[model samples]
Target: MGKKDVSISDSIYDRIKERVEGTGFDSVDEYVEYVLREVVEEEEEEEEPYTEEDEEKVKERLRALGYMD
Candidate 1:
């Protein structure tokens, strides 16, 4: 596999190092890979929050359909 070097803050690097040791990962690269995978999973699972505007639209549709009195 190919590798790429990226720059990060000292604090972030330190935190990733800590996680690498704490999780018994062999290298910082492994820890970084795990973190990036988690971030992508979280982004995929995230959805827009429900809002009053959506509720109002649904209510209007229901009224138009005579489902509401």
Candidate 2:
């Protein structure tokens, strides 16, 4: 896929440039793309949604410990 251009604040750009010097990144854009890809992938792995059965189990546990009526 082709890359897209995105704008960021000068301060953030400077920060990325500073880190790029010692890092294996060839440029700030490369580092940003890598970081963004990792973040996007991590976010994609979402947890399953809560269901009524799960809520009922919690209530049962609370009742066993005398925390619920």
Candidate 3:
């Protein structure tokens, strides 16, 4: 895959540099890529469409809480 350049504040870069010291990451770019990939994976996982059973459960909860008739 082709790589592109991204800019971040010096302070953030310094923080990441310090955090990666004594760890497996060789550079700030690798650490940032790993973290961003993890976050994106989590977001994708949460994007699953709600099912009819899921909607019914939410409605039932609302009824129990007196938010619905």
Candidate 4:
């Protein structure tokens, strides 16, 4: 993977390092990337949350149209 050196404050680096100690991450860089990617994936999956009620409505409609029993 391509990498670029990012400038972070010593305090911020220390914070990440502390978390890294017990997280099983090999390095601070890996932990940071994992967190960033998690945030991105969460945003991508952000949409209407389907529920059982919604599913039942569709099934009811299909039954009404003789598409299902």
Candidate 5:
């Protein structure tokens, strides 16, 4: 994919630059991509919605495994 130009605040940009130096990432794009991946994974985790049937299945499994009262 072609690169995109982005503008960020000086403080946030400095922090990304500092982290990139320790992480061996040579460019702002690379560091931003890594941070974006982390954010996406976190969002995916938050978006996992459990239905009523899913909760029931978990309760049954826990009972079968003797983890429930």
Candidate 6:
């Protein structure tokens, strides 16, 4: 895969550098990539359709809490 360069503010870069100081990440770019991947994965998971069983469970909880009739 090819790589691309994206720019960030110097302060943000320094903050990420400080965050990864004692961790496994070797550079700000690596930590950013890892975080971006996690966020993308979460968004993808959230795109799945909500089914009727899911709706029923939510309704049941709401009813238990007296928010539903």
- Best TM-score goes to which candidate? 6
After superposing candidate 6, which stretches have Cα over 4 Å from the reference?
47-69
Model 5 C-alpha lDDT per residue in residues 1-69, reported as the tens digit of each score = 776777899999987777566445678778798668767976887777768997798788556534576
Give the poorly placed runs of model 1, Cα more than 4 Å off: 47-69
**Residue pairs clashing, model 1:** none
TM-score of 5: 0.50
Give the Å error, residue 37, model 4: 0.2
lDDT of 5: 0.73
Better of 2 and 4 by lDDT: 2
Predicted structure with the largest lDDT when compared to the true one: 3
What is the descending lDDT order?
3, 6, 2, 4, 5, 1
lDDT of each: 0.72, 0.77, 0.81, 0.76, 0.73, 0.80
Mark the 10 consecutive residues where model 5 has the least summed lDDT.
Answer: 60-69
Better of 2 and 3 by lDDT: 3
Worst 10 residues of 2 by lDDT: 41-50
Which lDDT value does model 1 have at 48? Answer: 54
Global CA lDDT of candidate 6, please? 0.80
Compare candidates 3 and 4 on TM-score and give the better one.
Answer: 3
**Count of clashes, each model:** 0, 0, 0, 0, 0, 0
Over 4 Å off in model 3, which ranges?
47-69
lDDT of 4 at 30: 90
In the range 1-69, model 4's lDDT, one tens digit per residue, is 788877889999998898677445789999788778867966886795648997798688556534588
RMSD of each: 16.1, 14.5, 12.7, 15.3, 12.2, 11.2
By TM-score, how accurate is candidate 6? 0.66
Candidate 6 residues 1-69, lDDT tens each? 889999999999988888777666788999899879867976897978669998798688556534589
* TM-score for each predicted model, relative to the true structure: 0.50, 0.64, 0.65, 0.61, 0.50, 0.66
